[model samples]
Target: MMATPAQPDNGNADVRAVERQQVDSPFFVQTLSRELSASPRRIAVAIVLAFTLVRLVWAYALGFGIDESYTIGQSRFLALSYFDHPPLHYWIAHAASVLFGTGWAIRIPTVLMFSATSWSIFCLTERLFGGVAAVFSVLFLNLSLFFLVSAGAWIVPDGPLMFFLACGAQVMVRIIFPSPGEKEPTIIWWILAGGLFGLAGLAKYSALFTLAGLVFFVIATRHRRQLLTAGPYVACFVGLIAIMPVLIWNVQHDWASLRFQTGRGSPQFAPSAFARMVLGQIVWLGPWIAIPLVQSALHAFRKGRTERELFCVALAVPAIGYTTLQALWSGAGFPHWPMPGWLFVFPLLGARLSGRIRPAIHYAITISLLTLTLLVTAVALGGSGALHRLNVPALHDPTEDLIDWSPVAKVLTPLRVGRPDGPAVAGLDWAEAGKLDFAVGEIAPVLVLGRDKRGFATRSDPRLAGRRGLVIVASEEAWAKKGSGLSCLPEDPLPVARVPVGRAGQAELTLLVIPVEGCIGAAQ
Candidate 1:
């Protein structure tokens, strides 16, 4: 007979199962504060909560910046896609407005996206390295000025793009390194990853860079054969399907979106342009974070411990290379265009710097402290009139593009109210059009009166073509010297109000009354 087998400890096993279940529950996250040193889960929750509170305060400290104003204008019109970017940012802001009614309330979605991004970073880093590395990654990311403000505080496409990109990246990591009992990354997970990538594309066209990164990883890894499998194809199909709304919109508009984006690509290379791109990256990422990100990427590529490590580095290349070459050919590019790639680098940095994170830990803390100091000080100084009291020269004017427009609105509102048919209001470009729309769009129809159409091109109403209107042009006196406002009107008009809007109060406002036959007749 076989030796008597020891009876299983059923009661102890049941107790352990209950503990595991409790730990895995989302409710357990907050309790980790009790064991903060040993639990990354609780640490992540605390960091995210703290970051959320800080961003909430920052959001209310100032009015919307120029880009925020533009996005707000777009939120008024719901479309499949807009002239500038995908519509998701506007859609989300629109939802926020419905719930909270504009003002700083619109920025709530951005704060939430930032939180999700932080959590995703934690999960991704944890999967690749360990819990400590995950915590470091969250701190590293939140400390970067670009990530802290532009990506977090502002209502821009990057926030949503980063959130989706992080989600997809985390999913990719899961697929690459399944848990102990899992045999393989299921087809369902691959489908889910593809869907996330698709949603990212819906957020911004730059998500193509992410797709390219994924493809590169698959090719470089031993999972190259997966392309022959249904998983890769399913992912591609899902992504394509997810972006269908954008495609449909473009199709309906004669592919205007595609043409517009394609035109932005550089036709040839220029070192100066490439240098500008590099400079932008350095400024955006901050020296401390940027240096380590690059070093980590290089190290991962040269001496990666496993296929997963190398694959992570591959995710960053397409965006970085594309932006760099685009800058070379175009002679200049936006600093934030390459940001999606940098998102991948953070997790890799956490993993690469596992044991060597001491130096960066201090740097992250210092930068966070200094940045908060400068932000609070700036707000305080402006509120105290110290900024205006400096009376700096025009070149050094801190308030050049940022002026309170209530005075101008005060003057224009009566004129608009006094008119019959609510005479249309106009501006020479999208910036003025958007600003005027925000200022007093409710008083009358607002139009962009120039060749650079933008969002207003589709909004131009034939009925308003012959209507009387006022055009407000806010710019430096130098712009006036160049006669920037004259090209939009058929006849000369007198100044209705010269209101101080920006630095030196050099902005101009003029009256233009179309003939009874209308502006359409005048233009012809």
Candidate 2:
């Protein structure tokens, strides 16, 4: 036994050593650090590319969302601004559609814009924090559900808004807090900041909150002297010039857009609404990421002493604070409203979490990917009618919202062509009109019979008044009520086609396309 003991169990020792190595430094962390160390920019670019690929797949997998359909439908007629948001994304969507044609291709512009946004965030974070933090910031930003799916891929204002806001913040950071030994920011930098901020305003109204943050930073910080210089004023003037289109449009329309926006905030206080809004934001940014972001934001606010900390706190506090408080009013605030302000906190979050050997980030990312995969798979299944076949309840299945009007289009195309009068299509409301309009494409004009027509009201054709067309009512009950009142419709007009507008097996709504003759005014 003593002689045999001399062998010394080398294989067991080797296995133990390898286990210790893994315990000390996870393979994931090691590979991540090694890749990051080689080139942070490359890692950032790779992240952007991978996310973009996912977005492309997602965009094609599901139909346009309600708001996306509305944007696409209304953007066919260009305007200075839109009722729901600024015109930049609408312009982008229109341009993308012109170049690539409609369908999922319209989302390409947004997907690409978010890629630029991620790069901007990376550059900003790197300049303020470090390369590792920058990479993590991009990772976290892309991992967030709202930022990833909605802002990243949807044909909404957030994509362009976030891109411009991030770019503006990066430029402003250079102007406000130049690195040690760096030259004073030139007028060009200020001008660039203003232009970018203005472009952000062109993307969404919430950009003003961020712009206010910038103004406050200058006033509250040691950089107030910059106010004495022409730079700040020039930036303001340039920003004003950039947003002139929105102002002009509002003026021309009797400030209808502004009034509408202001009207969204109800006077009644509701703590439940506030709680819901907060929870919505938490859900939007997954709990893992949101918890860190809140911690970073609070840390910046309470104990931050550095110039970068002051800057971030200044920019972040206003939007997040204001939106959260505004949510106390039952009608005010959306989950994404505070996102612009929260955007400035990501660098802080990156800095706070940088170089930490924690499994949370790894697990968060893994969970996010898994969640996204499950969501995408479910969406694909729903779109393909597989989920429908499983008897998934319409109420329980969220993918029902993703169902497009392609089936409706198939039924309406020949009917539209057969009518010599070339009747306009109509829907009960803006959402219905949007889906129908998108489906009909360039074949016929689309109109909303209801008063809440949104952008459609502004673009309504007078000629559609006297033309006979099909009216799409979602339910038999709805058609029974509204269809009977339209004098132009037959006394007992039969549905041209009963099309299901949701997942194949379980219809969310049944579209009753009743033929009518010149009843637009009465319906309205």
Candidate 3:
């Protein structure tokens, strides 16, 4: 190529000027700007406020589904325990129902529990670390896919479990961190902490993770050497004994529920299961997960350990560790297996951009988070058409599906209508029987047990065996295939109704009806 320096006088100079203008264009400037441009505090406030609204509003609009129906039944009955989880949630719901009433009313306690836990997370992180860490942890805890969904949407024992977990953590903070120069924490707070944990144990077994964390901190910090000399363990013992109602329930039922949960079997570990679980946590935790999450972890080894980071990191360890183990083994698990991760929010966030945010930055950040929440909510509620802006699944509506008991129950109800027949109902599938129980009430006869512990536990009690005038319920196909002999049915079965099955959304549930025989042959 020939050098053109001699032509720079006019044409070359004009070309150079045009190149300068191109470099200064708006697109180039915008491309160089920060992806997120808000003050951290504004970001934090916006996230919490938006999450609170979405959860409460969406939850109220929805109807009770399968699990809620069972739990409400348990609460009204106030048993020592249920086949799933524990009895604490039922006991709490029972109280809520007394005041709030059944159906949507009992959910008030769940709503309150969520609010308290959230505030605890906010305060704990802000005090332990710094504004950046606080915001980061809060965003991670609140916005996590599992967490956001569980907090307001689900009516499980987890709501109370999380509440007590947060309450216990807050009290520990006061006791461990102590005001500036205080020598020892007040005895009453320690007692209260013990009591809260005692109740937590009744709510869910996972709460034991918190107690384990406390024991770990005491040993890790070498404070356990003074444990016997410091305070009374009597109050703790009393609180523990207070939850004996659950223990008694277990004892009476041959510990079936607990044994069932503990004895869960899985085939083998899958390499991809652990990987996918981690990926799920990452999306749920959001961007903040990368910062204080990593920084706080490393900060633990520094000369002057980041105290706040330590607390949050230590708190989250149990949940993460347990979930990892559960993923490796074969058994039942849930996305909320990592629930305790939320406890870390306060400390980690307190230590992480916590200063001098601008006004425009606030609105910009709020809008960004709002967009994320909206998209997530859309996917969760089973309508992501508009948000196809992202490549996420569009079908995950947890509640509000009709579940198709109408068809099976449809043909049978009329045949026995106004007649003084027995309350027998039959099912070849668990869903059909459960759905019927939902519609006609659990007292309906012939609620045949499902093959799984979750189903069998409800109806396989000796009390429900071979009752006269019982109705048998199963899917139309299953009923036809095994029409001659159902374990719960008599030798001679009578045809009652042939109900057509239908699909509701993505879920398929159908039922068939037959007369409940007085008795089946031995061991059926």
Candidate 4:
């Protein structure tokens, strides 16, 4: 045994030592910090491009979500505004649809918008803190799930809202905190800020919270004197003017959108709902990241000495506060609703995190990358129908939503139910209508049969009156629940086809195509 004990493997020992040095040593951190500082802009751009590439792949992998389907389907008409949100994102998606013919192409604008958002965050953070902080801020922004997937790649209003808000915040910061030599920010800067804020409003009504934050910042800080200047008033006026279209559209619709939005907030309080909402946010933002973000926000409010710290806190509080209240009161508040407000907290978080030890940063990055990889993998598997093989229960399978409804389109396209001056296709629910509308595309006039028709109610044509057509029942249970509504037809609905819809090779649900005569306008 003594003779068998030979010399140690120096090569392996050396490699282990090198690994430890790279992972554990401060020298590695210093080198990284120097590199990041040397070319922060390039690193930021690289982060944006890398995330953009991942998002592009993701966009192609998954089918459109319910909101995305609704937005794109309704965007075909190109209105002044939409039932759910303002017209900006819809217009952007519409333009992309026109150029690229819908499908995944509609998500292009949102994807690119997030790129701009990343750049804006980088610039804004660098201006407030420093280059290293700015780079980390962009990295953190892209790493967060809500920002990475929802705002980054999805066809949603959040993308444009985040972009415009970030840019506006940057402009507002310049106005509030001028350089040492500069006496005051120019009027042009104020005007630009207002215009940017207005565009943010056009993106989503929630942008008002950020605008309020700006006002609060002006009043609470030494910048209160700036509020007296015409610069502030002119900015407000410009912002109001920019969002006039939303007002005009609302006025034309008898303030229906306003009423709908205002009415969404519940009058009663719900502790469980509020808890769920907060937890949902933590999950969406990632627990590790969200915890630090909360700490950063608290730190900024408690001990922040600089104008930048107060600025982020001011802009962030209103949105996060209001949405949290809405969740407590309504119980129906969504997770992503508070995201734009949290967008401001990133710089503070970046600055905070950048000061931590290298191992901590590495740990956070590893966790974030792992989470993203898992999410992307799940999406990819679901989109490719591989997950269906697992036989996960339909209700519990989150990936079920990613199932392609294009199969339904293939079945219905030949029928031409939406043809003008002829029959129409009907869905029992608004969500179903959206999916149906997207799938059928220009081939048919898709309408909602039941109440809660959303935008489809306005888009429904009188010409469809008394016309016979096919109704797509998403499941047997849905038909069982709503099939009686079609009883008014002269004859019973004939089962035209049974389209098996699911992922992979398993059938999770079946699409029932039933032909009904003389019931085109009956259910609505």
TM-score of each: 0.84, 0.89, 0.74, 0.90
Error of 4 at 21 (Å): 9.0
Candidate 4 residue runs with Cα over 4 Å from true position: 1-23, 26-30, 386-388, 392-395, 413-418, 467-473, 485-492, 520-524
Give the candidate order by descending TM-score.
4, 2, 1, 3
lDDT of 4 by residue, 41-95 (tens): 8878888999899889888878876788888888888888877888899899889
Please identify which of the two predictions, 3 or 4, would achieve the higher lDDT against the true structure: 4
lDDT of 1 by residue, 297-410 (tens): 888778526776766677888898888778877775888999888888888787765564444444555777877896788566433434565666563544333344445556
Pairs with backbone N, CA or C atoms under 3 Å apart (clashes), candidate 2: none
lDDT for model 2: 0.79
Model 2 misses residue 411 by how many Å? 3.1
Q: Relative to the true structure, how large is the alpha-carbon lDDT of every model? A: 0.72, 0.79, 0.59, 0.80
Whole-model lDDT, model 1: 0.72
Residue-level lDDT of model 2, residues 1-524, one tens digit each, is: 35645656667886897667567866777677667767889888988999899888888887776788888888898889877777898899889989999867878889988999999999998888888788888888888888888899988888899999999999987777678999988899989988999999998888989888888888987889988999888988899999998999998888888888778866888898899889999999878789989988888767536878778788888888888888786557788888888788888888887756245356546766776886677567757656445664553555555767767767776675335576677877787678777777567777777667788877877457465654454455466555555556556667877987665555666788766666665443
Give a tens-digit lDDT track for model 3, residues 375-479.
Answer: 556545433222222335674434333233544545656656214444455444444445555555434443444354253355444244344455666665565
Segments of candidate 2 deviating more than 4 angstroms: 1-23, 34-38, 355-361, 385-394, 414-420, 467-470, 473-492, 501-509, 521-524
Clashes of each: 4, 0, 27, 3
The reply for model 3, stretches above 4 Å from the true place, is 1-50, 98-102, 130-136, 181-183, 230-232, 266-269, 280-304, 329-332, 353-421, 426-433, 442-446, 453-465, 474-509, 518-524
Give the total clashing residue pairs for model 4: 3
How big is the RMSD of model 2?
5.4
lDDT of 4 at 304: 33
How much is the lDDT of residue 208 in candidate 3? Answer: 74
